[model samples]
Target: MSVLIKSSLARKIVMALSGLFLVFFLGQHFIINITSVIAPETFNLWSHFMGYNPLVQYALQPVLIAGVIIHFVMGFVLEIQNNKARGLSYVKYKGGANASWVSRNMIISGAVILAFLGLHFYDFWLPEIAYKYIENNPEDATRYHAETVHKFEAIWRTVLYIISFALLALHLLHGFASSFQTMGINNKYSSAIKTFTKIYAIAIPLGFIFIAIYHHLNPITH
Candidate 1:
């Protein structure tokens, strides 16, 4: 385990795998959340099930959180290592000449995403924990839709969400294709895969932004 952590190749592989896992999770989350726009009842049903399900709450949720931690931690580690290497090796390394903006500053975008996650967990997850565990409130399956909409009623939060999601799109623009490359996926289909990733990178974050803005504009009343 220690040896693997020291290996840059191994770390990149782990980062790649964890990134792929999060991508799938993000897609699943987007699917469920999009229903809040198209079908509120369906969204409520899915949210209630996920919130109450033992497997999700007890098992999968922890794993997902750990994946987020691992991916970010490894990202920082690799960035630090790369900087040290560059300092030693490249006397006149030009970042703009060598790498694209998104690729060069993944850490900046990642930091924004991390901060957004903190806000997100504060808005939803902590309230949930308080409601269910601390307050010991009875499960109200019908409450999910209203609560979701209420969270978006704040225009500041809605705008922040949109901005964060735009940064998320930027992050994904580089990350999606690079994860495949890190996993040794250079082949005939690599070009096609990059194209698909570019589409997904733009689409998913735009979808999330739309959801936030929609709920903000169409707040529930009474």
Candidate 2:
């Protein structure tokens, strides 16, 4: 069991499984956020509902935190192991020989996405939970919501979101197919599976980009 845990294959499996879980979470979050574009009031209501749901929070919050830490740590470990095996003098191998560009740069893209997540948490989650719920600051709570609205209204923020979403799409493109392969799904039908996953990868991220643009152009009136 100890040997299996330290093996490269085992680490890859862990990374793939945790990554796939995070992808599912992203899909749900993207769908919920898109509501802000279609109906701001409905979005706010849904957000409030999610915020107040203790059962949901109790179950999901810890899972989310664990998923993030596991995914990030596993990725770094895999990369370090690969680097050590290859040695500093070794030429950087081309992933196109086996994987996509996104797969090769998973660490870089993931780091960027993580940075964005920090900003997102600070701008949205921190205010929603820490200030509104814990600190009991009604004024700061309202300001937080207004800040989100204002941020989305700005062209710069919209552009930043679009760029981040594009990176996310790239990350998903490789991650989706790789996760399936890691899970031992490769076969003659692998091509078809990869194609479908590609479509989903592109569609979900584009959907998020569209929502960002929509909200930026038509800021919601609170």
Candidate 3:
């Protein structure tokens, strides 16, 4: 078990599993947030439940954080290892001949995604944290709606969101089907997986961009 974990293959496996977990999380998060546009009450109620639910708060949230950390850390490690191996190789390697641009530049795309995530946490998650834990504020389900509205009220913030989501789309375009490949899911269904991944990569980011645009155009009337 220890030897397997220490192997390079093990790292890829862990990254693949964690990446898939995060993909699942992204879909769920988008679904929940989209409710703010169509039904304010529904969004607020679900957001409050997610924020305060004991199972989510204590169990699932920690797991989610761990998954994010493990996936990114392993990605960085693998990239560094690959670069080092390339440097030491006597034969020159032309990576672009084999893989697409996005496949070759996963590290760069992942870095951009990490930077956007930091900004996102600062703008939305941090304030929510302050309201919930630090300030001991009462549970107001509707607060998240206004918070999201205020976030998109700034044209710059909305632009930032669109740009970040665009990068996210690029990242997922490569990552989604790659995860399945890494996990040894190559069969007849592999083509379907790739097709679905491409659709998901495009649709989810567009959905997020839509949400930001909607919030920017239709500010909350408080």
Candidate 4:
């Protein structure tokens, strides 16, 4: 176990596994978030459950954070190691001929995605924490929908969210297929995997973007 941990392949394996975990999270999160547009009451109920459930709060939340941090840190490390090994940027490069733009620029997209996540935490997560822990706000699930609508009222915030989701789609387009490749799943089903990855990448992010836009435009008309 220690020997595997010391290997380069092991680091790649960890990054791939973490990336896959995040992919699963994205699907779940997108489904839950999109509920705001389709079914408000159900959305609130689920949001309350997620926020207040002891097991999710204590165990799953921490695991999710660790997975994200490990993936982010390992990605940066791998990029740095690869660059150092190359010793110089490619001259007369034709990487674009073989690889997609997202594949070639994984590190850049990953960095931007990380920045976008920070903004998300600032916009929603931090306030939630402060409300729950610091200000001692009531543990009321009914208020979540109103809070969500109010935040998207700002055009600029909505725009930033759309942009981030677009970039996230690009990031996932590469990441989903690449993680499978890293796990040695490249075989006759590779084409199918790529097809599924592309669809998921576009659909999930677009779903979130639509949610932001919908809330922003149709803000709780009473």
Q: Using Cα atoms with residue i matched to residue i, what is each candidate's TM-score against the true structure?
A: 0.93, 0.85, 0.92, 0.92
The parts of candidate 2 lying over 4 Å away from their true place are 1-6, 88-91, 94-96, 137-147, 187-189, 220-222
Query: Which residue pairs show collisions in model 2?
Result: none
- Extract clashing residue pairs from model 4: none
* Candidates by lDDT, descending order: 1, 3, 4, 2
TM-score, cand. 1: 0.93
TM match of model 4 to true structure = 0.92
Stretches off by above 4 angstroms in model 4 are: 1-6, 89-96
Candidate 1 regions with alpha-carbon error over 4 angstroms: 1-6, 88-93, 96-98
**Please, what are the lDDT tens digits per residue for candidate 3 over residues 43-120?**
889999999999999999999989999989999988776667567421234465657777877887888889888999
Ranking by TM-score: 1, 3, 4, 2
Best by lDDT: 1
Query: What lDDT is obtained when candidate 2 is compared to the true structure?
Result: 0.77
Worst 10 residues of 4 by lDDT: 85-94
Better of 2 and 3 by TM-score: 3
Candidate 2 lDDT, 75-115, residue by residue in tens: 88888877777664113666457655666688888888888
